[model samples]
Target: MLAADAVRVVAFAGLAAMIVAGRASLPLIIVVAVVETAAGTLFGTTEHAVLRGIVPAEQLPDAVARNEARGYGVSLVGPPLGGLLFGIAHTLPFVANVFSYLGSMIGVALIRRPMRPAREATPEKYGAALAEGVRFVAGEPFLRAVLFIAAPLNFAINGVIFTIVVSLQRHGTAPAVIGLTETVIGVGGLIGAFAAPMMQRRWRPATLTRLICLVATALLLLSAVLMTGVAAAVPIAVTLFLAPACNAALFGRLAATTPDRLQGRVLSVIFLAAGSASAAAPLLAGLLTTVWSGTATMLIFAAAVAVSAVVATVSHGLRQPAPELTTTRQAP
Candidate 1:
């Protein structure tokens, strides 16, 4: 992960240079996006795995909630800061991203504790190792439920959001207002992240998971029914208010329960499932909006999430008691 961030620093610097030289093109942008995304994915998976080593199992939830808080805090600033820097110079945002990666690399290097447990290198095939991870997750009812709930949830939420943003722009909503909507959403997430630890203590993980689905469905339906950009932002913001607790409950449990060796692969599979759906969402929303009203598009997304809510409500794995976090960390 540290190495991946180092590579990102160099990659983003190269992109900045290309832009400064007026040689940047669509293909260059595409290449940068691909590299950054792949590297970011690697960094994210490794970060989760490494957290297991750094923090005690019982404290993983609080640690994850703090991380979520920090992420939302950054989201509250990163975009507008990037935009300001971009206005100053085309290369400025890229340059700033390069520095951000460098900062992350330094943070990783400063960690004195072992990030991964000692393990002997074996002549294991990569495919076989990956399959083992997949099989492990598939066999675990909790993980399987997470996968099923998360993927479509990501798809629907992202699709509805895209439709809302695009529709807002089409209706000539002020850019500042649109930006403010994002800020409000970020604030909602930030607040949720801060409250997550308490919420986790008070509620079953399954109950929280079900509530997230139900709330998201309700908010999406409200957004569809209202069909006004700024008015819809309220429901969206309220929806985001539940996100941090859900993530901490779900992923914190995952980090606590999953074997260290399978952490990267298990997380990679789940992230890929969710991310693939997200990647397709905007495109599908665009296509849908061309043929149907924005309300209709949002309604379709709400319906999808509603089904997930039902699934989550009856999920047997979720009904089981949350996994005990008493297990010691395992060797990678």
Candidate 2:
């Protein structure tokens, strides 16, 4: 992960230099994007593993909640800041991102504790190790249920969001209004992050998960019915407001249940599933919007999420409490 961070810093710096020198090419940009994405995946997986190692079980919920809040808080600033910097100079935002990566590298370097799990007596091959993680998650009912609902839910929600953006663009919505809409969503996320720890204490993970799904469905339905950019923004903001609590509960349960050594693999699998859906969302949105009106496309997306919510509510596996696991740091 440290190496990945270093690579990311260098990649961003190189991109910035290329842009500044007026020497950026399509192939160079594509190569840098691929490297940056791979590095980010490595960094994120390692970060999750390290968090599990360093934080004690009892405090993990709060720790993770705070981390979520910090990330959302950054989102509140980063987009607008990036826009401002870009306005000043095309390369400035990339330069700023490089500095951010450097800061992350420095922070990682300062961590005093061991990050890796203790070595096994006879380590499994890479493929076998990954397969072991997949089997473990698949065999677990709660985790399986999460994966089932999460993929389609993500697909629909992201598709709807893309449709909304494109619809707004077609309608010639002012750039400031669009920016404000995103800022509202960011503020909502910040509020959710602040409330997540308390919500976790008040509700079980299963109950919280159900509520999240239901609320998202309602919001999407409302957005679809309204069929206005401002109306859509309202629902999106409310959904974002509730999102952090749901994510915190889900991740806290995941961290509590999975063994330290398998944390990275398990998280990687979950993220990959959700990411695959998100990656296809824009294409799906475009196809749907072309076939029907944007409002109709949104309604279809809302229906899809509603189906996921219904499944989540009725699923025996999702309703059951997640299995408890020891939170003690595994010996290294």
Backbone clashes for every candidate come to 0, 0
TM-score winner: 1
Off by over 4 Å in 2: 330-332
Clashes of 2: 0
Model 2 lDDT per residue over 235-279, tens place = 877877777777777777788888888888888788888778877
Q: For candidate 2, give the lDDT of residue 24.
A: 90
Inter-residue clash pairs, candidate 1: none
Position 104, candidate 2: lDDT: 86
In model 1, the runs with Cα more than 4 Å from the true position are 327-332
lDDT for each of the candidates?
0.85, 0.81
**TM-score result, candidate 2:** 0.93
TM-score of 1: 0.95
